[model samples]
Target: MSQTILITGGAGFIGSNFIPYFMTAHPDYKIVNLDKLTYAGNLDNLKEVENNPNYTFVKGDICDETLVNALFDKYDFTGVIHFAAESHVDNSITGPRPFINTNLLGTFNLLEAARTHWFDAPNTP
Candidate 1:
């Protein structure tokens, strides 16, 4: 079976560039895109792979632990490329709570989900 690879922020800048490149070169892998669709994340960025058989797009919050956990259970992803971070410094300066939560807590949620899902799987890496 092809390995399932989870990509957070798959619709954002760097992620938008990397996903296509990675998928093109790694045909043996499948991708599950989890994006919160922030302002910078445009659907057009991922138009190329949107309908590909190997790709799946999920729009949701990384901060939602239950959703994150359920996704892992549903997909059993073999690997994760964590690209979701609220990185705009300008926005962070304006109150910064969203940035803080989306960056740190979101990352933590991903880590926890990945750990729970992959910890005992010898083939996960």
Candidate 2:
């Protein structure tokens, strides 16, 4: 049986670097990558795994509860590698709403979806 996982902010610098490494390292696991494709995120960084059988890419925001819940229900993810965040200090100082939404609210949404799907409805097939 293969294990499925959700990886957020996968188009960003660090997450993009990790995705290929993780896929190569864990051939038995399937990765469902979720990224909002922010200015800091570049799809070119993930070109290596574009055709990998065990990899999937989704363009979406982490703050979207409906989308997050749908992904959880669809993938039955066993784990999450959350790397999404608004990391620019200057931008945060200038405009903090996006940072708060993506970092805080987005994390909450993901956690809630995971908890609901993995714990509250463990019997879902």
Candidate 3:
């Protein structure tokens, strides 16, 4: 059976670099990529794996608990590779709210969703 792995910020620079390499090597593994597509994120970065059979792309807000929960319930993710964040210091300084929402609160939301889906409700399926 294939394991469902979640990649947060998979559309961003570093993360986008990782996904294709990982996907190529691990054909048996499935990836669910969640990215907010902020200014730092680019779809071109993940274009190779975007339509792969073992990959899924979701554009969303991690700060929204309901959305996070819905994603968890829908995907049944096994683990998370968190990469998403408000990466630019200048952007954060100028627009701290989005940074805070995407970094701290967003991370928290992803954490909770992972906990509920991977640990707490593992038996649901």
Which predicted model would earn the best TM-score? 2
Better of 1 and 3 by lDDT: 1
Give per-model CA RMSD. Answer: 2.3, 1.6, 2.1
- Using lDDT as the yardstick, the better of models 2 and 3 is 2
Cα lDDT tens digits, model 2, 40-96, are 899999999999989999999999999999999899899999999999979988899
**What is the lDDT of every predicted structure here?**
0.90, 0.93, 0.85
Point out where model 2 deviates above 4 Å. 122-125
lDDT by residue (tens digit), candidate 1, 1-125:
76999999999999999999999999889999999998878889888998899999999989999989999999888899999988879877767999888889999999988887778656757
The 10 consecutive residues of candidate 1 with the worst lDDT sum are 116-125
Q: What RMSD value applies to candidate 3?
A: 2.1
Q: Which residue ranges in model 3 land beyond 4 Å of their true spot?
A: 122-125
lDDT (0-100) at residue 27 of candidate 1? 82
Model 2 root mean square deviation, Cα atoms = 1.6
Which lDDT tens digits does candidate 3 get at residues 21-42? 9988888899988888888889
Sequence-dependent TM-score of model 2: 0.95
TM-score of each: 0.92, 0.95, 0.89
Cα lDDT for residue 61, candidate 3: 74
